[model samples]
Target: MSTTPVEEFEVIIVGAGIAGCAAAKAFGTDGRKVLLLERDLSEPDRIVGELLQPGGINSLKSLGLEDCVEGIDGIPCYGYGVIRKGETVEIPYPIDPETEEQAVGKSFHHGRFIQNLRKAATHTENVTVRELTVNSLLREDDSDKVVGVSAQSKTNEYFRFYAPLTIVCDGLFSKFRKEFTTKTPDVRSNFVGFIIKDLELPLPNRGHVVLAQPSPILMYQISAHDTRVLVDVPGKLPSVSTGDLKAYLEETVGPELPESIRVKFIEALQTERLRSMPNGFLPPSANQSVGMILVGDAMNMRHPLTGGGMTVAFNDIVLLREFLSPENVPSFTDYETIAQQMNSFHWKRKNYCTAINVLAMALYRLFAANHDADLEVLQRGCFSYFQKGGDCVDGPVGLLSGLIQRPIVLIYHFFAVAFHAMYIEAKINGWSGAHLSFIMFFTVLYTACVTILPYLWSEAKY
Candidate 1:
């Protein structure tokens, strides 16, 4: 049997998705030899990570990967326009007037974005983009550190590659994450995606969210002519015909969208195939054996309702580069030193990770509230609070974008929304009676516990 050649690299990154490509660009720019492996080099067409929050855009710029987002026919997202009770409110992405750079998001085809990042990595002199499938991690006889990987080329040829650092960026369905951590992601919901063509939306640069019965539906323009719509379905959906799905959207959610897009929404739903993706959250942690690191969806994930996955991944790459680059940490090449550095890096990332993760999960619950009375109230309150405008909108949007790392800020806004809902309830039902007072008290308590406590628990463990 003929054996393929063995090669070496400073860093070996698996899966050439956003995270892997970003890592390659960062490390390669620093003159470190990087091997970026991807199963397929083509642009991805599936739904997920289609939007880049302002925080993620900043992180991309920080890594010098901002060019990846440019010239991809992306739609600049100002903020979000939420529709509830036949009313629409436009909430702009928080603007930091004092700072030079303005915060904004972008929505586009996921595949194009991935292709752009891959191209960026490929253009880096020290990064080699290889279309290969990583079979497994190569470890020392008795050590837990993963020193290399065994992979196969497209032609069915096997190969071995060793590196000082191995990064797993295979994303949400990562096969290697189990080797390091036992935590399984909580499958919270699923998203159904389709494209609505040739429609002029009410808010051109805003993501449109409709609070429909059963769950919320998100609509945003991906290109000049195509708008992407994602419907959040809580739990596993039983098998239903395409006609059933079309009817569901037309009856429950399609009316909530702008009239111009209603016909297109119905048409998009008529197609035989609709792409579905599970929304999951894997508690964020920096736990990895020596010489091995996990980044992006492989390490942590959150609900996608806020479109924060790419933001988290890009920020993670920036942080990883800051800590592991020779200019910052000289011992980055050593196994023990690298392991310790990652441990410290984990704690350093606590603030941003906590804020982003909690915000995504919490926001999804609020947006996708189908049957829960308190959550339904909170959802209405959230929309009304945003309609009132000012800090209420900016602060929460900042948290969603990852520009704001303070968890307390998120807590404050969440309780404020809850309180606002309580006030509305009290006003509508009359606060004179003991029954109303008791109801108000419990509503406030329940909202606080659900929104604030889960975030606290995650932060503490983080």
Candidate 2:
């Protein structure tokens, strides 16, 4: 062991992913001495998990990195289009005229954005970037009081760093979680996809999540013209690799994409290894300790199926900014309470996310079943929505936009709109207007509930 000195900072951040990097940048620029640790030193690249919602966009604006969000070369996704069992509907982004332009988010090349964040963290005046592996978390007096972290850089050297607060932003499967008591994750429907270049088709600025004939499919044109396809490739058929890219494209993609572009995308896949995933999520966890904090993915996951993780992570930051006293941030007891409340926020979203995953996969399977009736059912449901300016997707979309964040209401509204669509579509397609006017009567009942329930609930609270 070389006799060196242990260094200390105001905050210590572990992990280099978006969550960790965001925390480091936030705390560092505020002039808090920060040390950011990452296991790998290489710059992050690749196109996995590229989707970003408006909440994520607002996160950047809060950090004064609005240019980083807008200037990046990502295709603008105005909203999401869902392919349902018997319906298809487009969920456009919900924006307020009141917020700054940067608060509005569009999809981007995630790898590029990561690089921009990396540069920001390392360049900040009060921040120190350390490349090393954490051996274990340090605790004081064994009473769930976290003191700091002990790590070893390569070359088998030992070093320790301490701070008033320790942050673990490590990704899902984070070893950091073991440092604190946390609930095991309940939901984990992972999503995996590949980045394709030179897509010949002029893809929509707005993305589409389709219940294609085979896998439930998610296709988007990212910040650049590069394309991403999220599909539940059969997990048993063996994980496809670059070598299998040609066969997979010929068999799976050729039929779905435009004939002219099918071969082009195949070629791009050959050049770029195409991949898929089973599911991805970071279950909500808390510090459960004194003088410790968990931020971003560390606190919760916005399942990739929903593409809401980044947005939720941003919200976590927002809550922290409001609750975390930048000037004389409170003691560990107070910090833990604030962090737990934030965790609860994402926990509610995760439940809805899991429900959406089941819903998406079910619809994808129904569409793939290719039953004519199913397609008609889906089409009619969609018609019912726009036919009456229905808010089928608005509830979830607006929540992610941060326009409406009351979790209980947000979750209730999604299911409410979905049930309403079902009733309307059923009425128009089959039920008799005279004999089954009961459906429309029930619709009135539903409308009454939707209107009065929220008020009644609020007054109850009052």
lDDT of 2 by residue, 1-462 (tens): 762478877888888778777777777777778899988777665545577766667667887655665567866667766644435466677645576332345777777777777777788778898888887778777466777788887887777898878878786666866566444443423344666675643335666656544445676777455778665543344345434645755677456654554576567655665554444333444345577777665555433555666666655655555555465354434555645654564455443333333332323333333445433344334335543543655555666455555556544753454455557665666765554456544654454345334423322231
Best by TM-score: 1
Q: lDDT scores for all predictions?
A: 0.83, 0.59
- Extract clashing residue pairs from model 1: none
User: Highest lDDT: which candidate?
Assistant: 1
RMSD of each: 1.9, 6.2
- Per-residue lDDT tens digits for candidate 1, residues 1-462, read 244888999899999998999999999998898999998998788877889999999998999988778898999998888887778898888778788555788988899988988988999999998898999999989988788999887778898999978999998899998987888789977888888777677788998888877788898898998888888877775346645655665677777666666787778777636778888888887666887888899999888888888988888899899888886655446767677778878988877878888888888778777878888778877888898999989898888888899988988998888888877777766785777668777876687578667756865775
True lDDT of residue 109, candidate 1: 89
- What lDDT, from 0 to 1, does candidate 2 have? 0.59
Model 1, position 255: C-alpha lDDT score = 75
